[model samples]
Target: MLPPVWEVVGAGQSLYEQGPVAPGTSTQVIADVPAGSYVALASCGNADSTAMWASDYPGIEEILALFPLTSFAIEQGATVITVPAETPAVPVQQSPSFGSSQSE
Candidate 1:
């Protein structure tokens, strides 16, 4: 059986790693994240093994069936997003007149 492990990968590197969830239970891990894009992945087997299984088995139904029987693949998560830089807020102020005020 493959060890259950959690990993956070960013910038093509493994940022954090944790786990080996106690046999038949779940677990939670806290990781310090820096400013960057990252993908969190958790698996019960070796690297890419879960993905391979998913491909070979195919379909959610089949995957569900296989999971309870084999418990090979626990979960797969991936996402990447880009946020546009925000424009700084500029205080609006009325322009001062070049000419001096005339007496009424």
Candidate 2:
């Protein structure tokens, strides 16, 4: 039997698209993560395992929504983290008249 499949989504853009990952798969950050909230989805057991298994398991979309950004621990199993964008610094303006006065 295979492990399970996990997917991560950030804001409107999907960081990690739906896919099957091994049970021991290392946690990875999702793409397009905004400075705000996000979601994650996971599915256990293989689809072809059995009808009963599939029926008992929750859908990917449903599971993803169930796991909110707040619930995720910084150090834990497959989880998503929010990354803040860096702000650009403003350029300082120089006085044009100061250096030109003595030239005349």
Candidate 3:
């Protein structure tokens, strides 16, 4: 399973990023970004700026399991934006049976 990643994006550009951090673990990310409105997002895979709006990816399950995001702005000085400590629930896909169409 791919680990989660943290990203701060604005105007279709990535301002700051942290991770592919291990699952069930946390880390600190500090970056001096310009003052602007940004959106913080976390995902259980390596979905970067390039694949921001991608509908389909290799591991759609990981992409689909995303954390809650909040938009914020930094007027000046230091700013601290936090990604909530929550685990994304990855959906399990059941394989189809070609042998029989009837339920047992």
Model 1 pairs in collision: none
Score each candidate by Cα lDDT. Answer: 0.41, 0.41, 0.41
Q: What TM-score does prediction 3 earn?
A: 0.29
TM per prediction: 0.30, 0.30, 0.29
Q: What C-alpha lDDT does candidate 3 achieve relative to the native structure?
A: 0.41
- lDDT (Cα, tens digit) per residue for candidate 2, span 39-96: 4433344455332111122233344345432222222244334456854678978888
Sort the predicted structures by TM-score, highest score first.
1, 2, 3
Could you tell me how far off, in angstroms, the CA of residue 15 lies in candidate 1 after the best superposition? 2.2
Clashing residue pairs in candidate 3 are none
Candidate 1 lDDT over 4-29, as tens digits, reads 22222224555445555466766665
Please report, as a residue range, the 10-residue window in candidate 2 with the lowest summed lDDT. 50-59
The C-alpha stretches of model 3 lying farther than 4 A from their native spots are 1-12, 46-104
